[model samples]
Target: MELPHSTAPAADRPSVAHHRPGRARRTRPDHAAPRARRPLSAKVRRYLWYTAAAVGIYGASLAYAHLEEASHQAVQATNAAH
Candidate 1:
């Protein structure tokens, strides 16, 4: 079976002259450069470091707790088997 052609004339159809096969149209001009980002303040940096240290300490504590519990269970099992 064949597909039906458009009833409208070629001139009446929407133009796609600006569109390319692979590339997209840019919203801004090509010559325009992006703005530079501002660096974090000393106070903000200190807080970030504090937050990181806290997270690290908490993770270490959790890992230590798990190791201690596993060791305790192994000891109990050994005692029960003897």
Candidate 2:
């Protein structure tokens, strides 16, 4: 079978000097550095906290459902007795 070739010229190919699949690129200082990243704003941090809390609550509910059959049965019995 014929080998696949990149559309980019060899020189333009992403530098293998610091390249690996699933890893970040690290270029020489001579090359222009990438833009600086922004820090998380208060709103973003609050949203992350809320998301973590929601996941924790969901996991606790699932664990309770799996582990506490007695509580569920008591609730059913109470409803039936009413």
lDDT of 1 by residue, 8-48 (tens): 67786768665673456545465578777899999999999
Question: TM-score winner among the candidates?
Answer: 1
lDDT of 1: 0.86
Task: Report lDDT per candidate.
Answer: 0.86, 0.81
lDDT of 1 at 9: 70
Model 2 worst lDDT window (10 residues): 18-27
**For model 2, what is the C-alpha lDDT against the true structure?**
0.81
**Local accuracy of candidate 2 as per-residue lDDT tens digits, 1-82:** 6556855478757666534654455546655777789999999999999999999999999988877887888899999999
lDDT of 1 at 62: 100
Query: Candidate 1, which ten residues in sequence have the lowest lDDT sum?
Result: 21-30
